[model samples]
Target: MTVETIDTVVVGGGQAGIAMSEHLTSHAIPHIVLERHRIAERWRSERWDSLVANGPAWHDRFPGLKFDDLDPDAFAPKERVADYFVQYAEKIGAPVRTGVEVNSVTRLDGRPGFRVETSRGVIEARNIVAATGPFQKPVIPQIVPEDADIFQIHSNRYRNPEQLPEGAVLVVGAGASGAQIGAELMRTGRRVYLAAGPHDRPPRSYRGRDFCWWLGVLGKWDLAAPAPGTEHVSIAVSGANGGETVDFRALAREGLTLVGRAERYANGILYFGAGLVQSIRHGDANYLSVLDEADAYIARNGLDLPEEPEARDFGSEPECLTAPIRALDLADAGITSIIWATGYALDYSWLDVDAFDEMGRPAHQRGKSTEPGVYFLGLPWQSRRGSSFIWGVWHDARHVADSIATQRSYLEYHAQAEARSA
Candidate 1:
């Protein structure tokens, strides 16, 4: 096997990897990005066809590139977002080797670096940056029975409503993806049932500007403090047209049957908990808490902002607030498709290093791994709440690159001293 050595090796060629490569190049660091598939493979293959970015285009810009020509306020589609990454790689001439799958990453016994085994060849590097973003693999619950007659698919594989069988659809997990997909399926004149969970649903727009703009002004996106017991809730706001809010209350009013958390699948039946109304109420309370914090911040800073809009009373929809049914037979309800939007799981099995925590996740502090010369990027809450977003990875990437440079300088100094002594 051929062996090549470099200063650094970056795994995964997504936004995080590309951003880190740009910073590493600016620092004159010799590195290459290894991708198992094409650049932005997840965005291209995993997302739905009609999906657009959850946030505005303005907030999704990378470090050196801006969406100058595109409307900053409009949400860019999935294809456009994927193309942006492709264009970025070309613009910066990033040293990305596509289709190169990493087989293993192991530390050198006596050396001061690591050996990365790949499908193409083996690379020895002083530093290794795992830039694989948070959504590593699709998570399908084991509770789903294998012998079921109905067709099932994860949100990653779902394209559009037409892709599924002609019948009612049950979308499990009412996060951004689940809510959006359920709403879209409803528009197709299909009956949709959403297995709701405790997920915060912020208004799409507030006053005369987007809610994201408010978050930016309030410094909410840059917050790094650990929020206890709120890890699974997605911060992504829904992207429904007509400036309409897309929360549980809104979806309920739009003819979506809201169920409780899914328990398990029995003999042709799916069981649910009885906390549907409680979950929705709790999620709304969480949303209100965020707005209250923003309001307090504005008041304390004495900043002149737009007048708060009059609140809409969602209490009129009392039917959605009722107790959920404990179980529903799939055949009786005429439901033929099940879409699991229960989020994703991280896989670092190829990494032959002991840098993971009890959850099998990489153990890193602000992108710096516990193991020397190893780093991680694109992890949710890695440095701040925005660490996993396209616009946020650059901040962590810059820090990791600087840390690598400092370590490289020290190694060189030590080598020179040893040569002089010899």
Candidate 2:
């Protein structure tokens, strides 16, 4: 087999890969990006037509470019974002080899650093950037009963609610994806049931003022600070900081029956925590009192300045309490479909790196992995609010690229001296 050598080989060509490629090219670094398919194929193939970004356009912009001629608050359609990425690749002249499937990477003991096994050929590079995104694989919860006759699908596979069954639909997670799908189904007049999970629910605005504005004013998105202790404070949860809250909650108020965490589904019956439905109602009630206290805190101390972090927004809370039941009970309520809004998992089995922790994530400091030259970008909670975000990947990418460049230059200088002595 012929062995080709390069300074670096970047794996995966999604948003993170593109950003890394751009930085490498700008520095005139020798690197090639390997993609499994045509660029942005996931975005083009997976997203729905009416889907807009849960976050605003400003938060979605990639490195060194802004999304102009678009509303900042509006979530750009998937197609638009995909087009932007395409244009970005073209503009930067990112060296991308599409339709190449990388099989594995093996560390070379001497000379050519590492060898990448791919369908096309073997590539030898001193460094490798695994830009494969975190959400490459879909996660279907184990709690989903195998014996259940009802159709079950992961959120990644879900394009729209058209494929759902006729009767009422039950959605399992309440994260951004879960909430969005739940709200959409409800809007289509389907009887939607959402299984609320441990998640933050932020609102579109705070007291009529856009929350995005506050995020900017607070300089929360700035990349200057190396590390902030309270970075994951209340802002960690979507609505815990007293934002407008999610569209899912609004849907719940509309008519969607919010359900408890599903323990399991078997024999067409969905089992949940005993009295969980009532417990949730009780929590909602207490949350209402908490909300009142929060509102009082906010009112006492204007939005401009508060003595301490604000309380969670619950409006006034629900007055009613109810008991949780099994999925078989759904038959009585006429619920039919099930949307597993459960979140995704990170899959790195394809990569031959030994730097991963028990959770399958790379052992890294900021962006530097335990492996000397290997680095990670676009990981969730990589740095701060910007870590896993599409726009935020650049901060980590830039830092990693700089570190690599410095190390590469040092290696080059030492090699030159050895050559002269020889």
TM-score of each: 0.95, 0.83
Instruction: Flag regions of model 2 displaced more than 4 Å.
Output: 207-209, 219-244, 247-249, 274-330
Q: What are the Cα lDDT values of the candidates?
A: 0.84, 0.69
lDDT of 1: 0.84
Roughly what TM-score does model 2 have, to 2 decimal places? Answer: 0.83
Per-candidate clashes, comma-separated: 0, 8
> Number of the top candidate by lDDT?
1
What tens digits encode model 1's per-residue C-alpha lDDT throughout 40-91? Answer: 9998899888888888888787966777667888888888888889899989
lDDT of 2 at 29: 88
lDDT for each residue of candidate 2 in 149-209, tens digit (9 for 90 to 100): 5677777677887877788888877666676777778878888887764443333554444
**Clashing residue pairs found in predicted model 1:** none
RMSD each, Å:
1.8, 5.1
Model 1, which residues run further than 4 Å from truth? Answer: 242-244, 297-308
| Ten residues in sequence with the least summed lDDT for candidate 1 | 309-318
